[model samples]
Structure formats: C-alpha cells, structure tokens
Target: MACAQAYAADTFVIKDIRVDGLQRTEPGTVFTYLPFRVGDQYTPELGAAAIRALFATGLFKNVSIRTTGNVITVVIEERPVIANVDFVGTKEFSKKDLVTSLKQVGLGDAQPYNQALIERAEQELKQQYLAKGYYAAQVTTTVTPLERNRVDVTFNVQEGGIAKIRALRIVGNHAFSESTLLDQFSLSTPGWLTWYTKADQYSRAKLNADLESLRSYYQDRGYLDFRIDSTQVALSPDKSSISITINVHEGAKYVVSGYELEGNYLGLDNEFRALVKLKPGDTYSAKALNDSVKAMVEKFGVYGYAFARVQPAPQIDRKTHEVSFSIQADPGRRIYVRHIDIGGNTRTSDKVIRREFRQFEDAWYDADRIKLSRDRVDRLGFFQNVQMGTQEVPGTSDEVDLDMQVKEKPTGLLGLGVGFSSANSVSFNASVSQDNIFGSGNNVSLSLDTSHYYRTIALSSTNPYFTQDGISRTLNVYYRTIRPYTSQGNNYKIVTPGVNVQFGVPFTEIDRVFFGAGFEEYSLNLAPGAPASYISYVNEFGETAHGFPLSVGWQRDSRNSALVPTDGRYQRANMDYSPFGSLRYVRATYQYQQFFPLSRFTDVAFNGEVGWAHGLNGRPLPVFKYLYAGGIGTVRGFQQSSLGPHDAQGNALGGAKMLVGDFEYQFPFPGTGVDKSIRMSTFLDSGYVWGENEPLHLADMRAAVGIGVAWISPIGPLKFSIAHPIRTRPGDQTQTFQFTVGTAF
Candidate 1:
C-alpha cells in the first residue's frame, strides 16, 4: 500500500534528502538511484523518474516521494528474499534435481520471492511429472514469511497413478496389416511384462518416434509417395488412460528405370556411377537412393574435397509407376589441414592419443585417415564418445582445421562373484582392473578366486606405449591350485606357479602379432581318495615338473565396438610350445567370430573355436595344459570342463583336443527403444572335448540351445543364460542356468 500522504504535485530537492521505511536497504542506496540530488532543483518530472528508477531495481515493492518545505522524503518497502525452497510429496524426481532445475529458472534460494515466478515453477514441476506419464498430478505452492525479511517456499505435489496407453489404432495402411504396423510402434497396450518395461505408458516423444518409424517403413519399401496424414491422441476423463490413432497413406510402389551421372565428377564419372545401388529393374527405394548419395559424397572426401555436395533429381512417370534419377555432384575446393586440436582428455595424456592419429598437420585432408584416427581413439576404451570434424579457416576457402573432441569415461572395472553348491559350500571370486591407469594408458589387473576345491591369484600389467612406437609390453605372474570335487570325495590337488612377459607389434591398422616366453612349475599332491588318472599321472611324471613355454599369436579385429559390437569379424590364432622342458608339448588354438546385421535392431553372430595339442621332443603333453570345454564361455547347459574323459572316480580329465561353436541372434531388449547397452540374445551352442587317442566325430558333439541377456552396467558387463541340453550323452552333467559378471570376448 502507498503512504497515506501522496507525493506533492510540486517537488523540491533544495535542502536535504531523507529515506524512510527501509529494513535491509541503506538510505544512501536509494539516493544513488535518485535522478535529482540535494544541490539540484527538483521538478515533479524528476521526482517521478526517481521513483520509477528505484522500482526497476526490484529492491523495493513500494515507493513514494514527498516534499515538506523544500525537503524531500522517500518511503520504500523491500521485497523479501527467499530463505529456503523445499518440495513435498515428490517421488519421481529427487529434490536435488528439482533444486538444480529451479536455479536455472531464477527461482532459487536467496532470490527475491515473486508470485509470478512461483506460479511458473509450479507449472514446470507439473510438466516434469506429465512427461513421465503422470497426467493426474497436482502441484500447489506456499510461501511463508520469516524473520529478517525472508520467506520459505514449499511445493506440495500429489503425483497420481501414471497414465497408460489403452488403445492404439492404425487406419489406411493397405500394404501392411494393422498388426504389422503396430509392431513398429514403441507404445502398446498393457501386457504381462509392462510392470518392468513400462511400454504401456504414453510418452509424447515415443509417439513421435513411432510416427517416424511408420513413415520409414513404407518409404524404404518403394512406396515413394507414402505419407502420414495426421495423428490424434485422446485422454480419458479420469486422466488415467490414453488412446492414440495414426492415419497414413501408402502410395503406389514404383520401379527404377535407371540412373545417370549428370554433373562433373572430376572426370571420374564411371567411378561415381558404379557407386549407385539402384538397378534399372529394381524397386525404387529411398534407402538405396540416400545411400548412393552418401557414398558419392564420401568418395569425394577421399580425394581431399571437404565440401563435396551430392544431390539426386528424381523423374517419375505416374502412368507406368516408373522412376529415373540423376545424381549431381560438385567437388568443392581441395582443402589442406592447417592444424589439429585435441580436447576433453583431462584424464588421458595428449601424447597417448596423439600417437594414434595417422593424419598429419599441414597435409591435405584425407577422410579415411581422419576416420581411422577417430576409431583408434575410440578403441582405447577410455572414452564414451569421440567426434572429429573439419572447421574451415576464416578468410581461406582451401584451408581447414581438424577438431577432435572426446568424452572420457571410467576405464576401471570391478568384478565380484558368489556361488553356492548343493553341499552348502560357498565360493567367492573378485578382480580389479584399470585399462588407463593414472592417465598414462597403462593397464593393470589383479584377480583372485577363493573356493574350497579351487583357488588362484593372478597379477598383470601392460604399458601400451612401452617403446614409443605404438608397441605394447606386458608382464604377468600367477599362482593356481585345482582340486576337483566329486561324489566320491577326491582328495587330490595340483598347483602351478608361472610368470611371463609379452610384446605386441602392430602389423596393420586392424592386425597385430604377439610373442611371449614364460616359465611354469607344477606339483601334484595326493591323498588316499585321489582319482586313478591323477595317481597314474603323478607316478609317470614323478609328481613334479617344470616347463619353459614360448608363445606366438596373431589377431585381426574389425569390430565397430569392442564391448558391444553390432557388426564385424574377429580372428585370432595362438600357439604355445615347451620344446626343451620336462613337459615338452605343443598346443595351438584358433577362434573366429563374425557378426551380421539383420536389421536396425537385430544381429546374428557366430563364434567357432578349435584346439589341438601333441607331444614334442619325445614327451607327452602336460596334463595341466590340456584343453577343457563346456560352460558359459564354451557350451552352455553343461557342467564346466565335464565333457571329456573321466577317471575311476568319475572326475573329468581335460582332453587334448577341443572344438566349440556358438550361434547367437542378438536384439534390443523389449521396450528399451534404441539403447544397445542392454540386449537379449538366443543362442545355439555345440562342442565336445576328445581324448588324444579317441576318434573325432561330428555326431559325438554335444549341443544346447538357450536365451541370454547382456547388460553393459555401471559396475561391469553382465550376462545371464538359461539353457537346455539338446544332445546330451548318458553320463553328461547338465547345468541349466549360468551367469557371469565380467567382460566377455
């Protein structure tokens, strides 16, 4: 409210100035904003301007200026500062998150409280809840005055039940059935699994994505004139359910007549024409046309044309439903890289990443080299995102700069496991690893397993840039003991201690060769209930043996991602030989894996492995060096290492020959949308281990079929499978379920 006595029509500032009704603001502060000081004459206009200026500062809610005998008096009231902002009945979003969002809207603690701002905050909070499908939520704000001209703000919310998608209908989709079209949508009616997937909730963003998918489905299948006419969403009166309807037009399909290159392709018209994927008799597909244009542009980039442009002009015949297209390409000026800039590598040294770049500064831009550099950096497994782009230099059309940016992620892994047997015995396992230790691009790991029947500890370290030529050196030391568990209570054990050093040389961008040497000492201990095979081996090998092992290996990997690859091929082969030791033998193993993309969200992967060993220098292969098959990494639905020969006590004796194969179809988990970090796969696995003297037969291989879930979680990678053995032998041991909580290659 204004003062009882208003400002006089005539104003004067001849003698002095006095400010009243100020609780926190000082009198001098008001004078600073006053247009007229005591020494200057004051008119009614100047007095009104001073009041307007003081009000603009937001420091005072009310102000009045009056004059009594050439003296000026200014009365003001200050707005209260918000002392606290609190939320009540908020369960969907954390209070901290709400506070951060409020600060962005200028309505946080210490800010002057305003009714309009409070109203906006209430509406925004309601919007946040609505985005999560909580359409019936309510929000009410209260402001309470406090001491020292402060106030407390509180938002009371009643978040009702989430609105569900009850009905979904598609109209005018002739080429595809309604059910097929609905399958492409992410939203659906409530199902048994909706409690976990939440697919039955109505989200505007998901709805929009479904619309795009519907459009693409037709356009990619030669419906050149396909279009989504309109969409309608309706909510129930109770606001607890939603229904959506989408209307679309599936136009007539068209066939390609032909394609021609009309623009200058740098005198390489034939080369550019070969890149076109649309054949003359094939159906006209938008996907194929877009792919052709993209390929042409990338081809130009390969020749240093950074600003290449490619566009397709389509000519259609409505009468015959035929289309012909002409591709126009303009190879822009050739660009030279003036500089290269690296950013967002706070945890990793610049040298560690710079060494991986094949593109050099002051050279012509090569798209292939730039792409290779980006992939190499991403393959380091230290960053979540890596991006590279060319920024044209100012005042120069032929010069550009390469900007590389990365978003670093945690490169540390912590693994833990716990299991219980039928006899109530518990086993524990753990491992700690860091791939980029201390930001030096070094790797170190320690692993331990504590089980009543088996125990082991291993430590390893690697320096990726040990020689500064992209060569890597690694050292490994380990101790292991194995005591097989059987129904007859086998009381024998084997212990081995070993050390090794290895070095890797890069043969190509995707290939590497590795060599290593190691020394291992083994000892066998027996009790009264030991297995017959173990006792016989102990007698023949004299209970203790030493081996000097040498190893050579080669690998070629072209996977798009190391942790979760959707496509690529990986092949690795390794050989180990102990030529001059008591346990002289040679062992070789080869593995091949390839992934095929079946659709945007589906892939098929096949993995095959084979191993063989034999005596060398007139000595038999070491029993400890024999290969074992079955279990999660080999054949699921079978006991670990239980597919080979057995002793008198029915304990498995690992075989000298092993073969395993796995075929899996991977897809995103239902309701996950496009998130690839979590997915599901169906697998068919078959393998068997054979004794050195036994005949190898394909019919003898054991097989199993199963389903599994793979998750790249915050802690580590996790995999769980439930399988049923389809080709089990009479004495085979089967385990229907298995899970692992670490990375698997």
Candidate 2:
C-alpha cells in the first residue's frame, strides 16, 4: 500500500468514506480518528492528520490515507494484543512484583503491544535492581507473535553482585570530630553489623537520611549556620565497591542573647513565656527553640485554638556571634470540635478507643485532652501507631473535626518455649493471651509452666473499663506447686490453689488505687528429706491451712514509655491482710523506681523496695507468703531466693522482712546506635531478707556489683546479669551469672 503522502496535493469533498485493513478495530473507531467526515472538504493536511492521529493512538503499526475520485480511503494495520507476560532469571524481586511494576507503566497482557513500552519496561526493571545494589544487573525484552493477532512478551534479567561501600570520608568538619559526626549516620562502610543493618549498601534514600541527621546534629549544638555543601558517590570499575564523600560547612557557634514573645497570648502571656527553655548566654539550640514553639502552640490549643500557629524568627549577629529568637503566635478563630472521627481500627471496637478519649464530641477543642487521649490509647498496647489529625469541617470556619487514626497490631500472643536459667536449670512454658479480646478492650490470659522446682497453671481476665468512671475489674484463679531445695534432697512440695478479684479505681490521670480479696488453700506434702521449717509449720498450723486475704494498693506512674522508660518515676504501695484465715497476718510493701536521662543515649535508673510482714492473733504468717530476694530481680550475686535465713537442713527459709535497692547506668549496645530496645548496664545492688521475729539491721544487708544486658527480642524480653558479691556472709550462697527469658525485669 502506498503512503498517505502520495496524494498530499489533492483536495476533494467526500460523499462517502471507507476504512480498509481493519482486523479488530471498528469502522466507527477509524472514522473517529479522521479529521473530515463525509460531505466535508478533505485536503492534504487533513488526510495526513488522519493518518498521524491513528498512529499516535499506539493501536496501529501502519496507516495510509488515499483518495479514490470523490471518496476518501483510510487503511491501517492494527497492533497485536499482548497474550502473556513472563520473566526469567529474576531473583532480586518476585515475578508477581515485576509484573505489577510493568502493569503500572502501561505494559501488560491484553493491552496493545508497543515496542517502545517494552523497552521502557526493561529499563525500569534494571533501575529497580540498581536501587538494591545490583549494579551489574541486565534486563532484555523479547516479543514473539502468537495466534489470534496476539503476542507474548518476556523479560530476561540477570542480577549480579551487590555493591558494598568500601570507604566513607567526610570533609570540612571542624566544630566536631569526623568520627563523632560519622557516628550519627546510619550508613557506613563494611563492619561487623553491616550484614544485619545493611549499612554497607549504598542507597540514595539512606544517604539523604544520613545527611539530614548530620544537619540536625550540628543545628542542635549551636551551629545554626551549618550546611551540607555537596555529596559525591562513586562506584568502582567492577561495580562492586562504592565510596562516599560528604562535604559540609560548620559555621561559627552562636550563643543565645535573649528571646521575645510577640503577638497576643489570650491573656496568658506569662504562662506562654514560661514555656521557653532557652536562656540568655546559653548555647543556641534548634531543639530548644522548636520545643518552645510547640509548647506555646499546645497551650493555645488548650483553649480551643486548634488552628493556632507559633513560629520562631531568629535574628543573627555575626559580629558578636550571638542569636536572638522572636517567637510569633497567631491564634485563629476559636474552634469547636464538630465531630470525633475514628478510623484505621480494623480489629478493635470503636468503644474500646472512644472510652479512652477524654475529649467528647460537640465540645470545645482542648489540645491537652486530645493529647492525653492519645497517650491513654497508646498505653493500652493495642496498636502499633496512634495518630491524631485535624480537618476543617466543610463550610464551617470555626468548626473542625478530630480524626484519631490508629493502626492496630497483633494483640493475641501464643508462646511455647523452653529456656534455661541458673535458678531453673531448664523449664518449659506455654501461654496464650489476648490483650484486646474480641476487640472489647478486655484482657484474658492462660499460662502454664513446668519447671524442675515449680509448676503452675493460671487463668486471668481484666476489664479495663468496668464502669464509666474508668474503674477496672480483674479476676484471677491459679494453682501452684513449689518444691524447695529439691537438689539438696529436700523433696517437700507446697500446693496452693487460689482465686482473687480486684478493682482498680483511677484517682488521677497517672494514679490508681486497687482493692482486692482472695481465698487461698495451702497443703504441704512432706517427703522423707523435708526441710525443718516445713515440718515445724505443719506441727503448729496443721498440714493444711486456709485463708481469706484482702489487699489494698496504690500506684503512680509517669514514664514516657512503658517498654523502655528513660525518664519518669514509678511508685507502688500495697498492703495485704489475712484477718479471716487460720493464718492471721499482715504484709506491706513499698517500691519506688526513677529514671534520669543523662544524654540522648544514656540514662541512670534507681529502684528501691521494702517489705514487712507480721503474725497477728497469735497465729504465724503462712510460710508460702514469705518474702525472698535474690537472683535476677533483686541482688544478682546470690542464688535464687537464697539471700535469707536457712532451715536446719540448710534449705532456703524465706523471711518476713525484705529490703532491696538497685542503681544502674544504662547505655545503648555497642554498634547498635540509637536503638534503645537493646541496652547494657552497670549496676550496684543491695538487698537482704530477715527471718520471722528477726530485727531489721543494716549490718545484715548484702551488696553486689554487676553488669547486665536487656534485649527486647522477637520471642520476648530477655535479661542477663553477671555479678560478684562485695559483701557476703559465711552461709550466703552466691551465683555469679543469672538470666531470664520470656519475661520482663
């Protein structure tokens, strides 16, 4: 067929139109591409345009337009459809992912196959491999004609070796050492942890993030004018090695001259001014400045100024190298919450989250209440992320909507494992728990443990909001058997079965009071080599004893994070009274924990606990309820529960009074920068237990120094300690190393 240019000079008025060489395309479709209809004057330009438009649709491989007297003729050869798409020799990415990538770029089965699209897809595939460090990757596309005017497209890929970083150099750094600045980066040259962290792989995204970190590091240290000039990344000839060079400029350090608050503060100027953390003559810190702005804005939000804006304008003086900050505030129209929208909670019930919110619908917007609600929801441990966003209500200037977006996480835990510790040489444990059972905001757990010296089965349930006032109810039933000093031929076992109910009443945002009652039955099984204390207890109180125990407790926690607390205080005071039991006694305990962050990567923690128990109504306290302190949870330089008085057979005889104190300095694990989940600590622990009727004295206290590690692992939290006794008695039992798994310390 001749091309459309053969009749470029001809012009005519078409009385009829005809389309030829149409296999799957309709005549109407071809007519739609023509610039002239029947009875319309058709010229050389219109005929050429008709051909070009049909070809531009990518549906035709060849197009021709000609004139037959007064009738215009159009002919086109349609492109073949893609019958199938396939990939070969792809390992870096899955076949499904590759196909999806191709589809996203208009190259897939059943679509009109074009050679240009095939080439573009191949290039894109190669780029994806390059991003993953496969610098030598190769991609090629092949098209094969199939039946029914269709074709098959195949992508062949060869993924080669990964490019590793060989050297990293930072230039023009003076305010801080090169090593110090490099340590702040997440990317690095080959190292021991490179395999896990993938820090040795050169990534554009990682480099960008590292550069931002470097900028923040300088800005936070008074280098307000610091800048990253340029970054150069070079790959080796073999495409297997990479070298990075970062150029930076560290301007002169500046000190804060002063700060001024600008704009109306709604009659709370003094309150807002007090939120500023920066002071005159102090090193200018970007973090402090930003925090001040955030504080002021949040204060405005407390008064329903949801759209308030607080910005810091810095005035720099190069002569004196001093900077002053002027904070500007703009509180827009007061906002009232029109609606409280909840979203992204696929598994959790709305009630579970709504009850946690202190802010109510149709109320004035309060930033403090919304923040507290977010925190409370986070503390529930039911979601991976909780975010709050404000959206303007349509057609309303002073009304806004609060959207609480939550990403739910797995709340059900099934644990089955075997572990070894110095105390319980080997133990097998299994547990099933659901923190948000059925999305009803209730907790249920069943646990069973089988150890060499102890066996237990427990079932518990807790309703966090049993009442509208935020009162929690908990019920527990448990059975435990404990064998004391079984390795030393003391085969005595105490079996206890008990049930308890408790209620937690919220007194303040961070304080709660708990009251509970329990019924317990204890039976002693005396073997041939039972301890003397067990025999004496049986002789005095009989083989079996029952008790009705009542408990009252108070707790206050203000930690920033429940999992890894770096700042705040935790305190607890509890009392237990067995006034209606054969064993009449009273026990009281007080505990205090405080954490102080020394720097971004280090913290100091202190813990202190004291307990005392006394017999009443001429009946001795139950031996099973005695206080024992040692091992992983207390003074680590001693055997498990062995820091107290002993029976005639040298078995551990737990005491009625106990005291423990621990001081620790925790730092991040080496090579795992900024990861708080894994930490190392050097600690000093002192504790002791006194027998019944024994007077408490400081001389009897034991002390130890140790090093420990805490890691939050996939299975659970793990803690290990190695210590040496600094003060010991002749009869004291010492354990140099102890560890516990599947539990928190």
Candidate 3:
C-alpha cells in the first residue's frame, strides 16, 4: 500500500523469481517479503503489492518489481549500516554516556542509518544541555557515506555558559520581612560560597524545592491559608543569566479554637486523646497537627490495624480566624503478617540479621516491635540505609507481608599510612579492625605501634552471638614496653603484659551489664639516675608485682545515633577490685553524657566523668593503674595525662582520683548545607587529677574554653581545636592548640 514507484506489466505464467541490487541482504530475505511466488501469475497489481511489501521491511532504501514472461524480478538498494557514531565539541557530558542516550533512540553503531533519526538525536542532545542551565547550547548532526554500504554519524555540540541566578525576590509578604522568609529556601543568588554550594544555578527541581520550603515556613508559623500565587523564572535574551520572582499570598493566621474526636478509636479514647498536642489558645502549626495524627495512627497500628484510615476534619471560622478539628478514624480488620522478607543484604548471612528482628511472620502486626527491630538493625552500623514496609496479600484482607531492605556498606578497615595523632610528636602505626568478620556479626582487631617513645601490641575479639540469646563475649590481650626514660647511655624500661575476658548481658533495649576478670603483671628495671618517683614506687612495692582483678560495669545508651547524636542520654559505670596478690586496690569510674537538639541544624551536648581509686590490704595503688586526665578526650588545652601532681623532675605523677566535664554547642558550618557530618562547635572543658594522699579541691581544677571543627572525612573522623587555659597553678603543662587524626595500616 505504500509503494514509492508504480509497476506496469502484463500477466504471465511464472517460471522463476530473481532479486538484484542487494549487497548485504540475501535473496531469500527478499523472497520472503514478496507477494508473488516463482510459479504464480504476475500482473501489474501483484507487482505493485510486491513493491510495497518489500519497502515496508525498512531494510531497503529503494524497492522495485518487474515481470518478464512467467518470472518476476525484484530490485532493492539496502540501507547503509551505521559504521560509527561520534561526537565533537561535547564537553558537558561524556561520550560514552551520550552514546548510551543515542542507543535508546535506535541511533548507534551497527544500527540502520536514517535521516529522521539523526534529526531527533540532534534535538535530544540540545535538550539535555538545556536541563543543565546551558540555554545557549547548539547541536548539529552529519552523515558521511563509506564503501560497502556503510555510514558514520557525528554530532557536533556547543555547550554554552551555565545560566546563573542574578537576583531572587519575594513579593506579597505583609507579616514577615523578605530576608526572614528566605532563611527557609535552599536556593540563593550568587555569593562568596558559589564555588562549593552552587547556589546560583537555576534548575526546575531546585526551584520547586525552594518553593515548598517557603510554603512550609509560612504554614508552620500559623498561616493556615498561605498559598503560593505565582512564580516566574526569567531568562535574559543573551542566556547568560537568569532571575527568579515568587509571589505568595499569606492569608489570615488561625488559632486552635477547639478540637474533638469523632471516630471510633477502638475503645482506646483515653490513649488517643492524650496524643493531641494542640492547645485551644495556641497558634495552629501544621507540623504539630501532622505529628499528632501520625502518633494516633501508629498507636492504632500497635493493635494490628495495619490498614487503619485516619483523617483530620477541620472547621474554619473566617471571621474569628479560628480552626476546630476532629480526627476521624476507621480501624481496618486486624491483619497478621504472612511473611517476613529480607533483602539487599548480599554479604551478611540471613540468620545474622533475622536474629535481631523482633517482628516475625504469621504474627499480629505490632508497630513497637517493628520500630525496635528497625532501630536495632540500624544501630549495628553495618549498613548505609535500612527501610521497612508492609504490603497487603493479594485476595487476603487480613494478611500482609513485612518487607525489610538494607543497603550494605563496608564494616571493615584495611590501610597502610604514615599518619599520627596530634598529641604525639612522631608516630607510625598499623591496625586492622573488622566489626563484621566474614559477615558473621563477630568482631576482631589488631594494633601495633612502633613509635620512638613506646612499642605496643594489642589484640581483641568479640562474639555477639556467643549464647544465641544476645549475650556477648569479649577477649583482649595486650603487651607493651615503655622506654620514656631511656637515654643514649642509660636505658630504663617497664614491661607489662595482660589478658582479659568479659561477658555482656542485655537487660533491656537500652541497658546492659558487663562483668570480666583479668591478670596483669608489672616489671620495672631502674637505672642509676632513675626519676625519684619511680625509685620511690620501686622501694615501696618491690620491682615486680601482679594482680588478678575482677571488673563489673553497667551501661545504658538511648542515643538516636552512635556517631553524631542529636539528642539522647548515655551513662556507664565500671569498677575493678583486686582483693589479693602483691598489688591490691579498688578503682571505679562513672560517665554520663546528654545531647539536646536545639533545632534542625544545631545541638548541645554535655559530658561528665569521675573516677576514684584506693589501696586495699595495706598496699598502695600501683602507679600504672592510676587514673589520669587532661587531653582531647578530657580537658582540652592541657597536655595528655599531664593534669596530675608532678615530681621534682617535672614528670606527671599518676593520681588516684580524676574528674572531667565537657560542654559543646554545635551548629551548621557555612556552605555545607544541612549535612550533620561536618559541624562547627564551641566548647568548655574542665578536669583535674588528685594524688592518693591529696585532698579533692574544685579550685585546683583546670578549665579551658575553645572552638573546634569536626568532620567525618573520607579516611576517618578528624577534630581540630584551639583552646586557652583559664585556670592553672605552678608547673602546669598547657597546650593552646590541639588536633587528632587517626592512623591506619
């Protein structure tokens, strides 16, 4: 029906068929598309039909049919195959990516060449650059013929300058200033931070998001009738710059005049009523109302109503600027989970994650258990993301399936580097830590230090599933040799080696108890000019001593995050007692930490720790086990382990009691957006260490106030602080600036 040329011929008895002018297409392919057979009759109508059939295949550029005697002949020119597809002047996108885009449109290497497809590709390329703010971009395509019916396609592009926002303006604001309203926008005009923030770039997605932010700002501040009337993004004729204008209608503000419940809350009206957060006289806030409704739904979900329907019915009184609302609820039929499906955990075993889940298949849906399950899995820190969902079983109203998905991340570290902690003068070290060994949920670590002042080796292992009931077991072995007092001709050294075993039992989701026992020995060899403090210790307790110590601890952590907590409380208490052996003493320590979320982008944290040790069985606490403080983890601006009493040689003498307190206020760093990983904070730190015979005095504590920056960088967590000591006595070692960087090998 779509013949390009007419066929004029007379009917004849056919004897054979022939095809000509095909370089790559076989003769049989042409026969398959022909309307007439070798022995069939050939007429003018039949010849036209044959021509149309062959042309529809798209394999040929030209098709014609002729009849001679009883034989029919077809002549065709096969379309050229695309030999290559390339681009020039395309600096905005990679060539491989562009090729992929072209392939989706049937225009790529080895594809049939068509002028229509080539035009489409050129337009598509221009559209892509437009989306990236390149309004002046241009694209042109060319087709080059080659021997053997082949062709090469080329796209030439000119990616112009990215249009930037020159100005942004907000209109129709009567109650709030323009500057105040813009605080909620993610989009901004060009500024000093343009290079990193790219705030000047104009994209439809960014503009939409900024408009939503502006709308939420008004809604949260009691403007219930607020609406965005119009928005205009204007581009300059030259296409080098753009400008945005927003017009908002902030209607009358409303207050919560009254509210009531109208729906069946499953006879739990008392529980549902307590969840209402709005007061009659308070200004209406969209966020608070949404949260209250969400809480009510979750409460219903706890009773197996997975498909509960909750709606807010509001009554508006325009004259009085007041709003009244009622929550309408419909409790769907109780549903049971038909299956518990886990996915996206390729490296970790199914059992390792399933054991931590509280929700199970064929059980009544419980929101609390599901939430706890998700939190526990998230707290493992083995995944980058975890998500949960429920899907109703097809044809089953009362059955649903629980879906848990996770995104796995590296839970081990292996590195070789020449890095050191800020407190150390010179250092090189190697360490390996695997928190999820072989994806079995066990942990092990080994660290070796060969610094100039000391040499050390330590190994630790933990089995979190030691008893299958969540009881954990840990073992640690360490050996260290200290040569701080060594010189060119005289060498004084202290050798110590120890091993410990510990077990942990969880009493609740947020609390745990630990108990352990260990054996430790100390051997010190004194030189002729040994420090007086070391000589005194050797004279008092001899050169060799060992102890078998028992330890007990209680820990509770309710933080929402382990690495960068915004709000929560954490506490830990530990005590070690040595009732017998040459070295006998009791040491105890307690730490309490609290984080308060001030706003979405700011927080406050407070930390307090105290420790005390005393000798038992008429023996002094060993100098090695004494409590020490005054460092980055303790009171900043002071030397590490240098806050205790000092001897005539100005050497720090370990103390029996220690106290440290730290307070910090964290906020967003400029040009970083809302990323909590990088933050700036100002802090106050104070601590002190008292000797065994010295009396506790608050006046003796050293305090410092400083500012710092914390970033979870590519390699690890890094902190740099500049602190100034405010209280110090004679012989106090102070440091004005300090930083800490981890080393790995």
Colliding residue pairs in candidate 3: 13-70, 14-70, 415-745
Candidate achieving the largest TM-score? 1
Query: Could you tell me every candidate's TM-score relative to the true structure?
Result: 0.90, 0.83, 0.88
What would the per-residue lDDT of candidate 3 be over residues 1-745, giving only the tens digit for each residue? 2235545556886798888788988888888977777667767887777777877777788887765656666777788999999999988799999999888878888887888788888888887888877899988887899999999988888888988889899999999999988877777888898767777888899889988888888888789889999999899999999989999999999999999987789998989989988879888888888888899889988998888888887788989999899888898799898898999999988888898998888899999899989988988878888999988789989999989999997887653334222344344456778888899999999888775545689999999888978989999999987654122213357789999999999999899999999999989887765667678889988999899999999999999888788899999999999887887899999999999999988999999999999989777778777888876689888766678787666556669999999999989777797888789899999999999999999988999899999887667666788888888887776766765554322
Quality of model 1 by C-alpha lDDT = 0.86
lDDT of 1 by residue, 219-322 (tens): 77888788889899999999999999988888899999988897779998888888999989998888899999999988888888988989999999988989
What is the per-residue lDDT of model 2 for residues 290-330, given as tens digits with 9 covering 90 to 100?
99899888899999998898999999998899999899889
Poorest stretch of ten by lDDT in candidate 1? 418-427
Q: How close is candidate 3 to the true structure, as a TM-score?
A: 0.88
* Candidate 2 collision pairs: none
Give the range where candidate 2 is weakest over 10 consecutive residues by summed lDDT. 417-426
- Would you list the rank order by TM-score, best first? 1, 3, 2
